[model samples]
Target: MEILVMGLNHKTAPVEIREKLSVPANEAMGFLKRFEQKRIFDEQVLLSTCNRTEIYGVVQNHAEAVDAAKRILCEYSHLDLASFEDKLYVLKQPDSVRHLFSVASGLDSMVIGETEITGQVKEAYLAAHQNRHTGKVLNNLFQRSLKVAKNLRTHTEIGVGRVSVASVAVDLAEKIFDDLKGVRVMVIGTGEMAAQLLKAMTGHGARALIVSSHHEERARELVREFGGEAVPYELFEKKMGEVDILLTSTFSSHCIVTENQVRSWMRARHDKPLFLVDIAMPRNIEASTEKMDNVYLYNIDDLKEIADKNKALREGQLETCAHLVQAQTQYFMDWLFKEFNSKIAASGS
Candidate 1:
């Protein structure tokens, strides 16, 4: 069997293309199920994040699996396959295994050696397993990749400092404000990142928060946990007018807050500083809005740069982690190749 990965990533494509190709979380299980039904590969896993969407599978025919995945992804994303086929990087066999191991270990992340990719990798593996779409090949691959990631964290100091996007935002907040004890925060969306940031921000003596999300239940849950007030999405502007900090992470495709919206909100505070962190791809806040007085806006890439700086601080340990990934990738390929050979022999070819 041949293992392969075919997809576009943050390094290879802009958010416009990345977002267009992402599988909606609500639809991943069904889409994964449909892929299994086609029997295009021996094992498969699809990883979708703000920065990337990758499909990994082992197949008898590399071309067939690539075509199938491309078609399925294009179908789900509603994009023309021909438009993006040339843009994607397709890795096969040993390179595919190495790529995934690098990804799981965060060597391939936009911010090299960032820790969140491990959880994202684990989530993708769990989702594939829950859908019954993964077998021994992918199971071992992802499981081992995670183990390597854990070992990397242990053996290397790659993740020694502030690691997550939430944590980094909190770090930046500390730089801007002398103390968060009196700062009022407003979280624009109740997604995972926003929720995590809310938790991080709370410890810094944040005065209050207004949680606004499309899903009221989720918003209420986060509000309760973080000791914040829950509000509907419609009340975002109202909350924006009252807060010193705004952090947004949502699944919305369009800009939720624009320059005009912030302009009006700014008038209420006489241009008091408002820290805006837009963690979502296709950014929830408008880029133009940053030009407004006292509005500090940062997107995911900005945080990623901060993350890269954090990663660079631990360069003494990164080399050791790289060696570990290389060693583990080789070991996995040995077992994987042996298994494939045994399968072929059993077929009496």
Candidate 2:
């Protein structure tokens, strides 16, 4: 069987397109189950994140599998196939394996050397394995990729500095406020990203933090740990006028904060500058909000500029990372070829 990867990422497409193709973590398992029922590939795993959505599988016919994967993605995302065809990339065999290793190592991320993608990749693979959608080939490939990612980070200086989206967001906030000492920050969700943002903001001496989530208990827990006040989800908007930086990452299909809502809040604040950082996939704030004066809105795509600067700082580490990726890819390819040859010999005997 041939290993294949078909997908698009932040480099290949814009945020609008990437958001449309994203499969939320909660919905990934059910989507994988439906995708497997179609029988396009023997084993499959879907890796969806704010930056990219990739479908990896083992199949007999590479071309047919690529087409089927694209079709399934279009159906699931409700996006037209014609719209994505130009943006999509298809990789086979060693190239596919190399791409997976690079992604797991965070070389493929907008913020080069960011470590979050490794966990995202592991989670996606585990979901597929637990549902029995993946067999020996994919299981081995993902497991090895995760191992290579760990080794690369441990041995190299790839992740030595500010590389995550959370750190970058804090960096941007610092630029606008000049100092976080008197900044009043409000986090809309208590997810991993939210917690990271809180920690970074506090470390920078942000004066206050307010945590709000659909789940009150989770929000309160985060507040307790981070030294913030937990506000009821319904009242989060009411506190908007008092907030200088609004960080949001909620699991909502639609925008939780709209232009009209922010416009009304701005009136109360007398046009105080509001920095909005939307780190969610589906996006918690509406795109139209960016047009408002004194409203600084940054989405996942907007973070790319900051990430690019950080990438430049780590340019010296690229050669070392490339060497690690090459060595790991060769190791996986040798094992894969051996497995394939052994299966052929067994069949012949």
Q: In model 2, where do residues sit more than 4 Å from their true spots?
A: 163-199, 203-310, 342-349
Candidate 1 C-alpha error for residue 336, in Å: 1.5
**lDDT of model 2, residue 270:** 96
Residue 186 in model 2: lDDT: 89
Counting only residues 3 or more apart in sequence or on different chains, how many pairs clash (N, Cα, C under 3 Å) in candidate 1? 0
Residues 18-102 of candidate 1: C-alpha lDDT, one tens digit per residue: 9898877787788777678898877788898888888888787777777887888788878898777777999986788888988
Model 2, 72-154: lDDT tens digits are: 88888798998888999999878999999999999898778888999999999999998899998999999999999999889
Query: How much is 176 displaced in model 2, in angstroms?
Result: 24
The per-residue C-alpha lDDT of model 1 at residue 268 equals 87
In order, candidate lDDTs are 0.81, 0.85
Question: lDDT score of model 1?
Answer: 0.81
Residue runs of model 1 more than 4 Å from their true location after superposition: 163-199, 203-309, 315-317, 344-349
